[model samples]
Target: MNSPWYIGDPSPSKDESLVYAHGTIMVISWMLLASTGILFARYGRHLRISGRRKLLGDTIWFQLHRFILCMVTVATLLGFFLILIKEKGQWVSVAKDGGHIFAHSVLGAIIVCCALLQAWLALFRCNTDSSFRQIFNWLHRSMGYLAFFLSIPTIFLIVTESKVLPMQQDGLIAILSLWSAWIVIVVILFEIVEYRDRLNSKMGIYRVAQNELMDQTTSLRRKMDHNDGANIRSLNEVKLFLFLLHIIVAISLTIPLVVIIWRQN
Candidate 1:
């Protein structure tokens, strides 16, 4: 008896199953990566909370982060292998064109390389001196930019190839791709703005009324030991807003991963 859910012969069904599995893996890989990125970026600033504290104060959190990194790396490798296997017999000369195939290959390589670099930095670059740290920072910044640049092509390939090759269109795939792309763009823009602000501050040109007020308060504090409650409250508010933003974005990206699995079952 033929399975009602079977859409074709065994070979085609097997191929379809492989593609579906790869798609699912890709979704998982991206979600894990996004989560790791958010967590690292948010708490990374506090890695050195106290001057006397050594290497990231929270050992448990660091371990969890490392575990997530390992999981993401394994999932990514599996996803890449699946794609290669699925494309093996279907390979054509036209794949070398400057369209979906070319872009996918280039961007996919960049993503893998960036992921490796990130892992290397996290695992090995922790105890470096200032000079080494500066070099690592530059490498990290460059890799991040490259990853964001590659995400554009990655997204293009996913949408274009999926639309053309798949007989059954999955709205969820489209939504997930768009959502992932949107999150990447938002993160890139945020980093750009942050770097620009840092540059302006270093150049002594970025000054606002609030900054001037803070400076005055600092000077006054030197002479009179008094707590500037208003400034402290304002700073706390800014911190709260940033925290909420991080949580919201993290949860939003996580939703699609859950939806995809739910639909699959």
Candidate 2:
């Protein structure tokens, strides 16, 4: 008789193990991406309006975030393959019963789309010239909505599939899923609120600075206007600080995810 735990002779059902590991990694990657989004939407937006220079830490964090995103993309692809190859046998049962597999497939598709949008935004749209800033911003905003929509299915998959896992069936996965969902919601809401406030404040600042520059343009023609220079310098400084803060936030959010994955394994 074939052992349930051992799916086939000399093979101890690596599917489950792969699924678990890939799931955990995906969770971490998602959290990091969400954290980066929060920072960019909130603090980074403010910095852009204020015209701040980039700081060292900010540069490092941006690069690190990009690197992690790439890794996550690869991992997600691997997960797709693992599910397709290893779980082929169970697909029929999963599909016929309309259980976690359905939710997983839906969520997986959403995730893939969001990930692609993110990549496009980060690599192509974001680097466009100022003339296309509005277009880029619109794309970025749409991607954010897509990410939010994707999160719902992902949460469903996590909660529903956790019950089927042998070692992870003790409510740990459900609890974690709930906790992560809460965190994502809180962060998104907080950033939205902050974004509105920053927009208002930055517009006010820009108007005042522009007026001051206009007043000085006549007297300081063809030369560096002191007040305008000061405003530009101040904006650059704000950008630098915002960049550093974003990195700090990303690192802080990643720590808990790493810990959870370690504990789970």
Candidate 3:
């Protein structure tokens, strides 16, 4: 086998076309992965959202999630291959200002591995009353979140590395970067708000229980249940908002790439 140092391009900054293709493909991949991951985690997992009016169900959402995961896997592979072919002998570039390519490559590999692991675990997931269901769900969900988070930095680095100015003579990479950053920030803030509300809901229930009179146990139970229901309602509402956010992000991310791809041809 060849040395580890000889696998990627040593001078990626010099290749404008390679940078354009790399940035474009990776950005498109991120858009799909982010949208799918958000949908599965926030909306698909909930009975309130997925089970309403039979609009979606566990199996339906699960299948859709898996299908999009497969797409993410394919997109990741394409991006990885593009980097390897274009950035020859640059893996682990040791200079102070270099080697980010190697970092990007390694990160992409990790996300791909996480996605595959999640998919494999999904195969064994079952509906029967088995003890493994909880473990399987936990593992699947954790990996999904991890992979999506990992992709965030990879997308950021790969896009920003390409200095192509939007509407400039060279390329439109800069605008794509802004769109990506905006979408990521919004989604992240939304998730933060969602989780904070969840924590408050749990804390509210705990406090209510703690402050209840020993003789008023039934009343306390009623209060707890009401709070829990309200919490669920708020979570579903957030999920609905997230779903809309996903649509906007997806459209914003895709339209530019599609237009550029068409223009490139």
TM-score (all chains, Cα) for each model: 0.57, 0.57, 0.59
Per-residue lDDT of model 1, residues 46-70, tens digit only: 2322222234444433555566666
Q: What is the lDDT of residue 33 in candidate 1?
A: 60
Put the candidates in TM-score order, highest first: 3, 1, 2
lDDT of 3 by residue, 1-265 (tens): 1222222334443434554555566666667665665566554555354536233444545556666677776776676666667656455443532355457667877887886786677666776588778888788778877877777776555434432222332334555566657666766766686676768767877776676635556786788778777877777677667666766767766767656643431
Between prediction 2 and prediction 3, which has the larger lDDT?
A: 3
Off by over 4 Å in 3: 1-22, 47-60, 85-92, 95-97, 126-128, 162-241, 257-265
What range of 10 consecutive residues in model 2 has the weakest lDDT sum? 1-10
Task: Please list all clashing residue pairs in model 2, or write none if there are none.
Answer: 50-235, 51-235, 51-236, 52-235, 52-236, 52-239, 53-236
Q: Summarize candidate 2's per-residue lDDT along 1-265 as a digit string, tens digits.
A: 1222122224443334555555566655565555454445544433432343344545433444456566666666666666555555444234353456566666776777767777767777545467888988787667656664575566445445533332334454555565566556555654555565566567657866776767655555434445545554565465565555545654564565445434442
Which residue pairs of candidate 3 clash?
A: 8-87, 8-88, 8-89, 8-90, 9-87, 9-88
| Candidate No. with top TM-score | 3
Q: Which 10 residues in a row give candidate 1 its minimum summed lDDT?
A: 1-10
